[model samples]
Target: MTYWAAIARKSFQGGSTVEVPLPSSPKLIGASLLPPKHDPFYSQLFELEIQRHTTIAKRFDFHGSMIDQLMALVSSKSNVKNPTRVEVVTALLNRCIVNAAKKNNDPLRPFILFMPFTIQNLLNPLLPHKLVENYLTFFLVPIPDEGDLEIPTLVSNIQKEKINYFRKYKGININQTISTISNDTEDFKQNNLANTRLTTSLCGYQFYDMDFGFGKPEKVSIGAMLIKYSMVLFDSPCKGGIDVVITLEEEVMPNFEIDEELNTFTSLDPSY
Candidate 1:
């Protein structure tokens, strides 16, 4: 990667430009139609519910500092300074999960979560290229069967469980793992693939300084048709703000949009 960056620098010094082909290391994997064999009833049940549900898309702009503030509060309350972004995000997700559970008529059911994990070299100072790889990973977060617990405890528990799972299975072949998890067999008996409900992605990436010969773009965004019950987090064009693009069931979307806690940080019609 550094060698390529040096080559690019040399090319620019010679007053010439080069356009290389896109990297092919990461390939796209389409959605799988495999069933959860152990819990075929639940699989069929969610599928039927999905068909009857209507999808809706909405973009929300919220104060960026809200997360920082939440982090500060968490730190002060727990006497643990320097909380990571993931902690704050987990808190936010917990809020959403609780809200969704309240709106959901079913309590004993679990939800499917599909989040894209990006492996990028940008953060590695030794690597000087913008190449990145992405994998759609699945996680099952358990909601209460009856009422709820405290938000901080819920978030901390989920994060700890996830960290432990990754520590136990880190560096294994992701493709093989995904294949085994997706297959309808006994291999996934101990896994959590059978009960996933909500999907979320953190897309608020910043490449504002990326340039060739021209200046930076005024804005950047991902324009894709998302599936229902999914949420995407994006960096707003302006500073001190974040954008949440959510796809939910049509009936539930309006209720979600009017959520009091969510509305606290949201801007009024801050459309892009």
Candidate 2:
């Protein structure tokens, strides 16, 4: 998988085959002769079943007009300058999810967002070849108690957390930072219980442009392997818009879907 991924990355960057290093040993592993002990159909069947039993995923669309309104709101109301679409959307989702938990008679706990950051741009002069492994780091944004805070305020707070983390780890070695964050993340999870949520943005990744010899994909989905209390944001087919796939406890989904503030800007289960 890593070998193929490396090749794909090189191809995406218009690099030649010579740029990628060959594997040291060439060994072929054949399929097992015996029947599988468990379900052998879907690789993630167990994981998906667990997710299905514990959570539900809801898809929502935020149109261009909605995004514009959010941008304007962030600009006029918050101290965060030029807030990106991802930031605003994340803030809104976080707020709505927390509100849903509150309405569901669940305790309002602080949120810890696991946001992914690419390190390719941060490298000096850049690497001669892309690394096969993930060149990504997670930004842990510890959200304060939502209370009655508005979207703009939440956006500003999220940005502040990101900026602080970046500045603190700016000159540190990437490997060291990753190790430290791993320890910190484990501690946070142990201490926070059901408070932490993972939020990832694949918006600007141009996933729609990929061609697997079947032409461009009409739509892309993350499928059923989702973490509970997590949200994944993607760029909508239409420009200046976003598609959010959020997973929450099945019981809390109803309240989240009908959230007045969220409904003001999002179209639930929207068809293209």
Candidate 3:
């Protein structure tokens, strides 16, 4: 059986989060660790805080009118000296955005954005042809003090490393080789619990959109059928809010097996 080779990756970029899900696989990993919530806006209102406690640079950007409105709540802290905490970091980015927004009066300071679910370019499978077993995508919020790079640039930076791993693995002759995600934090512990089944939470149409009732869907989410796996932030107009679908591989699968019964049925009626 050709099975998906799964692994975990994480970022202490700002918030605390441990991710599990190798890139070769069709979806993102689980969130075992979450960073401390700095903005009352993100956690207080939305009930979720994304990782990115501190970056080596100055600012990170979030897009769409939905994300923009949420950004407005994190007040600027450009001038705070000796800042190390996630909440403190929030101010610095906000300050930069405010000044940039006011200087050119551009309400939205566009950041490098990539919609991973849009695989139009990947129809031919742009990924390395080893049938990528598993992988994870980390949301990198570079320091505000740094210059901006487009989504393609960011994707290139990440893929370059993993593809190299796949190359070396085949060079040595392995059954579906794998890439080792750097152990930045302690969150990427190996969980080898095979016989685990996948479910909708890890694969398909989830609960993040039932309330919209056909109103442009709030955001166009990709599904598991054609897309296999997908994840995108569901931004809200209300302050201190952002929803993330950090799907863990194992959690979703086992449920699916149980729900479907794995094509197994005990013969209560015996044929003579």
Q: Estimate candidate 3's alpha-carbon lDDT, on a 0 to 1 scale.
A: 0.26
**C-alpha local distance difference test of each model:** 0.51, 0.69, 0.26
Give the residue spans of candidate 1 off by over 4 A: 1-50, 77-83, 93-132, 146-149, 173-195, 210-214, 224-226, 238-241, 268-272
Give per-residue CA lDDT, model 3, range 86-189, as digits (tens).
Answer: 22222222233334334443343333211222112222224444332333222222222233222222223334433443343333212121121233111212
Query: How much RMSD separates candidate 2 from the native structure?
Result: 8.5
Indicate whether candidate 2 or candidate 3 has the larger TM-score.
Answer: 2
Arrange candidates, best lDDT first.
2, 1, 3
Give the higher-lDDT candidate: 1 or 2. Answer: 2
lDDT of 2 by residue, 1-272 (tens): 44444446556657445464534332232112111234232234335545455788878999978988988998998677789899989888888887887887887766677777765455444433534334565667776665534788877777887787667556655445556555655555454534557788888877776653345678877653356777888988787889988888888889998999999999897542
- Residue-wise lDDT of candidate 1 within 1-272, one digit each (tens)? 33344445556657556554433343223223112236574465466646766776777666668766766776776644565544455456546644764676634454433433432221222222333333334344555443323445545555655555455345545344455345523433454533544445554445454443344556655442335655666666567455666666666666676677766656534453
What is the number of backbone collisions in each predicted candidate, taken in the order shown? 4, 0, 37
In model 3, the runs with Cα more than 4 Å from the true position are: 1-145, 148-159, 162-220, 223-272
